[model samples]
Target: MPGQPSAYHPGPRPTTPRRHDVIILGSGIAGSTLGAILAKQGVSVLLLDGGVHPRFAVGESTTHYTLKLFRLLARRYGVPELEPLTSYVGYRDQIAPTSGTKRHFGFIRHEEGQEPDPAEFLQFSPPSKGLQTSHLFRQDSDAYLLHTAIRHGCDVRQGIPVENVELEEDYVAVIDKNGDRYEGRYLVDASGFRSPVADHLALRKPPKDLKHHSRSMFTHMVGVRPTDECLRVGPEDAPPIPWVEGTMHHLFERGWFWSIPFNNTPDSRNPLISVGLTLDERLYPKPDDNNPEAEFREFAARFPAVERLFKEARTVRPWVSAGRIQYASSQTVGHRWCLMSHAGGFIDPLYSRGLANTAELINSLVWRILDALAEDDFDEERFRYVEELQQGLIRYNDELVNCSFISFTDHALWNAVYRIWCAAEVPINLRFDRFTERFLESGDDRVLREMEKTAYPGLPVPGSHGYKALFDEMVRLCEAVDRGERAAADAGKDLMTTVQNSPVVLEHLGIRDPNRRFVYPKPEDLRRMAHWLRHEGPRELSYLTTGVGVHGRPLPSALDEELAVPH
Candidate 1:
């Protein structure tokens, strides 16, 4: 990780006889999570990692959804009451100028003379600005997860760096830095930013999925809160929280900042805060990288508010760091192999999606692998299904991330209207939460409906278009306001008018069909249909009904073939 996540030749296996059901590489969250899950299934999992976790790392602010998975995992592992060892009281972001605000739509920076076109906004977009601290990486979190992994039945091997895997006739063999050989029936590439197995086996390559606007640097400091001031002069929220906190992120001209809440100490009457600021190279410079640490301290000194947090903040002893904000390898799996690569490899961390996406991969892929080994036959159908599911999830997340950060070119006029319409109360608008819920309850039909719904909400939603047309009118109003037709007040008034008249107006734009019923998974009948297909085996139409495998491809040989022999 000191180097960006990549591969290194692990040399050769020591040619000793070692065996296990599964071989895992990397001990970061993704790999550890996988090891624990498999071990719980009563499978023998040999988890390998180059070094220990709690290494210099960032990208803390986790979303509400992450807790849900933790809850589920805890329940399954018999830890009924697991509190967040590390929790974000709220999320925070460093308020700053996003490329979208400058490039895509015209914007009135709270300052002045800042009008950005849409294209630039899309290229270098950041989430709409707001907040300060997030409670994502409060040391307790890393410790908690490692503890949980150990609590489960995982066999963790730290400082045992895995170089690559030899996809063998039966079992997959692992070779480490010191020429140790171990083989497992299955190989899981949970290697983080550095995907050793993926790189070695040529299963996938890292993709430069980023554009002109990507630079990230972060370090955690304790005492990020103000001990000297109360609400009178300090921020409204306590430090040790996440991006949803107060003006923490809302007061910047360049990239976003994150100050997370963390526990103080194992012994004592206080808690500490973890502060992180992510600035793009475009604005925050590394002009004199000769001493980046001194430069950062000097930079923080320039911004009084930012400086206050640092000056008062505590360093959690041996603060750590690594570059996390970058593109992920676009491809994950092939016919005979797959990857468990998480850690912002295929996505961005703007919405605190890194962890949530990681959970998604584990929840989907881990089980299929377990069931495969259990049945002594890898369910090729299930593998393909999970594979596609992973792809779909990636594509969906890419959209959300890209859409949220895309140049705010249309922010004032066009962009603002599009995003705001989502906030509007349309007759049958499917909110994002609704889409996620449906996806969980039932996989395929629900997913398709979500696709159509999110794809074209105005046409897709029953009573949303009046709002859509209202935005087109808004652009016209923007031109008028610029020309002094009415006041900026008049344009603001129009926005309200549209809001008030939305239902009727949307009817004109095609919202009044009057028959907005649920459009997915037609009840138990389909499930019974799926049950029938499941028993039919690979040739059965049963799998079709369940949405459990790839639609067009045959079941994978690993899944459809005979029992795997031990090496």
Candidate 2:
């Protein structure tokens, strides 16, 4: 059963709290996740946010690995078991056409540098069992996250905007919008880009934009059903009850759109479709909320593809807009006070990375701050670890972005470009492997035990060597991609195939257990038939046939989820 947050606690809360272990501002993914981690650690945490529960939000995409994370959160909290959520049919059950399923398998349209990378979307729809379970984001994720944090004992106070913070010798005191104060040993800026703590402490200087991907503006709708014209395009099948991403750019250039659906209950009048326009700023001007309709008109006039997508479509009410953003923290951490700078402050949604990064960062930082407070002193070393965690995250995005960049280029030289970029991002990958590493490494096991209590599972991911090979091969493949060699056309595909065939891949993908140690069909073993691989699609590669369509049983159903592991 959910915790009794339904209890009507009395009004007239205290004005100034003397002290707590830590103070977190922002209740989005990062703040909530970190709050949960810290609370479970037995640390007294104060989390203040600007919004109420189950508020409207936009981002919903997740890679193949997100299922494990969500499962972990569910188990940790006292919520019902995650199995139902995982196998929930809401996404496929939306009231759209039958063929309206998109990303049936996970999709990864990788573009190296602003170019279309078709194969980047994962192999096909329904990639694996738990794969479809990940589709229910945006709608249920927030409440799921908030309750989890509360279960961990986070002192979450919502709808209170923080106004000022004073860093004292022993503790930092924060003033809310109405001048009430709360004090704590450490201050965490899980506050998204709309950070009051960072602003109060002046932790941020000018932010430097990293390798930006593109921008997006979205709005909610109801009764906007999917059509056949939408289906034949990329990344859309029917109105997915959970979520749908449409890469209009793959079908057209510089034009991208997506549709995410949810149950129409409570707040909404009808099922909504999140229609969007994602494009490079270099090509079209940014949309202005000051006059979004006018800004959109300007874009439609200038960009033909975007015009066509929105021209005929009827967008329902509750129109919302968001920037497809990317950027690096100016100084996420400083001397006395540091910013746990969660989602809103970092880069935008290119590979659907924002929410995962947000939750992970929060969980990591809150644990660190809690540990530092437990010691009766601020553990600078733990904060340093927090810094490393965020840096590692940024590096992962860098690699992912560059992977899309090179994949999109499709230039003969792209292989080299990709390889070199991968070389750089590998170490970060090794360091930022999982949230478990962050929770377990803390000297104080209190937070960790709480995490364990919550049922967060370890993401059965690859080890360092697999990561190193991936990075090295990425560079090598980029170089290979550049050479335009016969054997190098789609080196990414070959590498993925080889890795999937590896013992570790089988284990990570849940194909075969490591203890049992069953060997897979090796890339080298299949090299004899490279001639046919030259002209095959993901569907063709889904088989285990002999040369030139030699008949074989269909590939394992698990291959969709298990083998197509994201780096």
Candidate 3:
């Protein structure tokens, strides 16, 4: 149920005064994972969460980049338990058995009353089988991580509602509802949206700064039909990977529907499927009835295919809805405290970047915090880079999701924008994978700082000049479409021209035929693409930009005056 609280499990009461190296707010995966890492390093850490584990939660998807980051973190920090959750095979063997394997990501565009066109369907498969991710059963995942943290010697207390947090020059004091006080050298907030630390510190920023605006209604259900079976596309037209074998998205003009299966395996006991409807509130306003399940059914019925898929599904829990899922913080770090990536801000779930962002932030912050502790400094200025990284990720997600909403309104724009997204996504993942591998080989923290410098909003690393220029142009065109300043057809044509002329995007994406436009490369092809990117891609940037549309174009004098590359 939406606001129903779980049964509070009162653990041992705290009587004696104690001080730890760090006091963490919230025992969610982010907080627990960070605590476990620090505790494993012999640091005294305490994690507190208002809600109990095995409770309902969302953000249930993962990606290749997420897997890579997890593996890197585990290997770098000596947390073998986390390495298991990085892949489908490992997750099943080591983690919970209730999770689902995500071999590919599938999307289908639908009209109001008509079945979706097979030609408009898009499926994105990861490069290799080892890199295949999973649809995380967050309840199980969170509980497992909490146990992992406890096993690592982190002092954890559940059902402890935090009342106030006091930040001092040398330590932080946390007061609970019962007026009990806990103190530690540093405070970290990992509680999602309702962050007591952020609220008390007055660090929240206006959500209007985000380009994306959305509301969601979601719940766990049973009996969702397989997407491929429901769609009934011809064998020849079917995706190389089965649509039902991964997280499926049913996209429409004003919104999108997510169908994530949790019982894809035969041994799986959980039959529940996590389903959600996200609507652009500006285009589709909520009904006044205030019934989430009813509103979900009414909205799902608008598309015939979605209606059929959910015909036999029955909700196992009450549906939950939110007014707006976008939020930001004016500051993510203070004199003696900081907010987790999610605790600071969240844009949307359009690309399943939540987990990836969370893992990446934890990885970076862990090292920074250790460094700060070694130097006996907890100044906010020391952690400003963490703030930049978090805000930069939110800005990137905002642009991606907001522009994606515009693409959904027109098939032509969708096709072009989807390609552009893939182009940006592939190389970015490849770069991060390589960067992590290198950092693992050489334990130099500077490698990470240098890698962070290359961070251009979305891509994992700062790519070639040609790649940046191409992506920037695409963003400009998409932003124009988002604002209704450009027609979809015209933008599509321009995007196609850009794709046709740019070999970096085309070759990286394995888009050999511009006419066919949709190509699913073999695993071997992707492997070769990664190899080329690491060895020869950087040296060829000048040649790659030779025939680009923006290349050699005379810039306006005012624009030239404003353009200066940072040192």
Candidate 4:
């Protein structure tokens, strides 16, 4: 049944034009999930895809934000089927068996013929089990979602290419390769990179504005060795979450390797592991031969540790390579039509933000569309906020990913840069969790809007100045490293000095004393910090954590031992 669009009963092609409340291009998770949500609301939906189910696709990682959004959408929209996707254990029984539990995000810097320095390795674990995420097998996950859409009364057609889109005043018309016409109040393009809607409307923007520029080569393979076993790190020295238990990132100068296991347990159906190499295009250009497999081998050999991990693995599918993967759209919304997240814009996948971004975009758009339909207003103005949100998110992503590439030049710099990433990510994750909980409890769209105001587009609420300052400094230091203007040792020392001097960075890293720098906190410390932040007043917590007052001056801190107690 793999690749089969389940519950689909194909009959004779439609002889007349078909109309629905909404028409979605591309049957991937984004389109199908939106379709299912709308269909459940008694809105007629049609989803068309150029390919069939169980298709090969990447972007198979999930995060805390993605899970929280899934839960929120399912609960708010009355779609219980999506609730299971929020947890690893629930997904195992309710979704598919092809996913792997992602307990931690691990990274190690490797050099040619030299073993990675254990001291330089980093592994980040979520403080709580509920926050842990999973690595998806997109083929299975997407098909399951598509089937769910069908079950929810969405009209889905596969292997059908959309040839033309005509936007009228009130509705959009879609013509397929078969000359069949479909019309709907709104047209949604989730068709991804080569978006026809984007191309036709001249929405595609040159990626020159983006800070990050990179190319990728990737494939799914079998017989890949577990990182723990390959590295031979002793159990005593191993991280709380084993490196093999989650996504492993092997870093080197100018590039990085991602190893995401699909088979972590004996029950996994697919033994294939997803592996990919992403290189900063400015530093490493594409190989002349253009054989991804051959190029991949050559690249892997540069890191002996990475090469050993993949030495015996055989590809389950053809290796795929792409030129600079960054893209952006000049506009995402027009009369009677709009583009989904991927279609609107996309940056690098280094942080696995794609799924989370898609979820956030869908959540915002679906509500707006529903409201617009109720009011009988489809003006382009109704969904303009979504465009702004999408564009801002992509810009934020560009900044973060672009800065991260500088880490590869040296392990010390990588460590410094990574702390900045963690500082930014921690608050964002917590704020998103809080927003989801608050919105679900109140069922208030205003809560969503208020939270949106505090966000830096693709980030969390309260937009603290401390976090912003840290991020800004990180970017400055990274650019300096990238330009070879700062020595790795000096950069590392500067990073420590920066962290020690910033109360916001200290709180983010769960350190109370600046004297003890770059220390990972124990589980208790993490839990205590999270509880304190959660209990504090929103505005007060923002200032306390970010070190910026409402007037932009450093806020006086009342933080002490008493506030650290868990409620």
Off by over 4 Å in 2: 1-18, 73-131, 137-140, 147-154, 201-209, 223-255, 263-270, 287-312, 317-324, 333-338, 341-344, 402-567
Candidate 3 clashing pairs? 454-462
lDDT of 4 by residue, 77-161 (tens): 7889888788777777887777888877788888777888777777765444354488888887898889989999999889999
In order, the Cα lDDT scores of the candidates are 0.44, 0.46, 0.76, 0.75
Candidate 3 regions with alpha-carbon error over 4 angstroms? 1-17, 455-464, 506-508, 511-519, 527-567
Model 2 backbone overlap count: 52
TM-score for all models, in order of appearance: 0.58, 0.62, 0.89, 0.88
lDDT of 1 by residue, 473-517 (tens): 555565465456755544555654554454322222211211211
What TM-score would candidate 2 get against the native? 0.62
Which sequence of candidate numbers ranks them by lDDT, best first?
A: 3, 4, 2, 1
Best by TM-score: 3
**When superposed on Cα atoms, how far off is each prediction in RMSD?**
14.9, 11.3, 9.8, 6.9
Quickly count the clashes in candidate 1. 60
lDDT per residue as tens, model 3, 302-328: 888899889889999889998988999
Ranking by TM-score: 3, 4, 2, 1
Q: Ten consecutive residues with minimal summed lDDT in candidate 4?
A: 1-10
TM-score of 4: 0.88
Better of 2 and 3 by lDDT: 3
**Cα RMSD of predicted structure 4:** 6.9
Q: List the residue pairs that clash in candidate 4.
A: none
